[model samples]
Target: MSAKSTVDAKIAQGKRTVVFSKSYCPYCRRAKQLLKDANEDFDVYELDEFDEGADWQNALAEKTGQRTVPSIWIGGQFIGGCSDLEAHQRSGKLKQLLA
Candidate 1:
């Protein structure tokens, strides 16, 4: 499958939250920790660990218009990055989304 297809497939399969992250990005780490603290089950793909990482990232950028790591999706909807997740959590929308 193409990178874009792979990303779309992952998002469409919303049995769990999806996070496209870089292994070493602090924001990625924090976003993951937030999910963990919320006891949310998530699938995290560390793009930095993949050979096609850049392709995936580029595909994500094209789809979401966000070029940074920790590109997150919940229930097939783009949830954005760490700060965005934080906002959702703060507003209790995260819990609603996880449901």
Candidate 2:
């Protein structure tokens, strides 16, 4: 199956999503905390632990279209970093998305 399909299946199963993060990123920590506070389980992939080569970063950039840490994808949809998440939460869209 495609990666997107796999991600969708995981979300449908009520699994926590994945966040690509880096150390020293407050946004990443906050994003994680928000999920935890909402009682959502999520997995984090530390980009710092992986090779910082162009290929890996490029792949992420292509997916997110931004080089920012804490790039989040939910149900295979690209969700921007912390501020974007907060916006969704404030707008009540996040609850529906999580539901």
Candidate 3:
């Protein structure tokens, strides 16, 4: 199956805290760290480590209208990339997604 379709299937099932990222990306690391610090459970798609990475990223951009990592989705809402998520954390809006 295509990486794009794989991602689509997962999303259709539920959000369940999914993040599209690159293992070597600092921003991705920062985002994951914040989630970890918050004790948040999430699944990760380390694009850089996947053979289908390019396909996945292309699909992610097409679907989310954004081409960046860490692309975060919590509770069925696409919370955007790393900085965007940080803004949510700063504004205390992150908990709402967790709950």
Candidate 4:
């Protein structure tokens, strides 16, 4: 899909979603695909350009409380990494959050 369309869908959903990702991370790609498969949308913040500075990682860690790829926030709540997202999908809680 076009990037603009993906972004527009996310905005129209009216739920705050943000993904902090690194370009080379497989988990990040998986997380994005999961959301896409579910027909959900989200904003993504790339950290691939940043150096391994504590400030950058610490900010994410502060928000997520976990230093991992594909840190996802749903409506300002930390839903966790890729595995956690998949678990949420299995449990049907991810839909509830999106709703």
Which has the greatest TM-score? Answer: 1
| Candidate 4, superposed: residue stretches over 4 Å from native | 1-15, 50-54
Predicted candidate 4: what Cα RMSD to the true structure? 7.5
Q: Candidate 3: which stretches are off by over 4 Å?
A: none
Using TM-score as the measure, name the better of candidate 2 and candidate 4. 2
Q: What's the lDDT for all of these models?
A: 0.93, 0.70, 0.86, 0.73
User: So what's the TM-score on candidate 1?
Assistant: 0.95
Per-model TM against the reference: 0.95, 0.77, 0.91, 0.75
TM-score of 3: 0.91
lDDT of 3 by residue, 1-99 (tens): 877788887666744898889999999999999999889988888999978887899899998899888888886678899998899899999987787
Candidate 4 overall lDDT versus native: 0.73
Predicted structure with the largest lDDT when compared to the true one: 1
Which lDDT tens digits does candidate 1 get at residues 3-84? 9999898888755799999999999999999999999888989998989999999999999999998999998899999999
Candidate 1, which segments miss by more than 4 Å at Cα?
none
1 versus 2: better TM-score goes to:
1
Residue 63, model 3: Cα distance from true site in angstroms: 0.4
Deviation in angstroms for 37 in model 3? 0.8
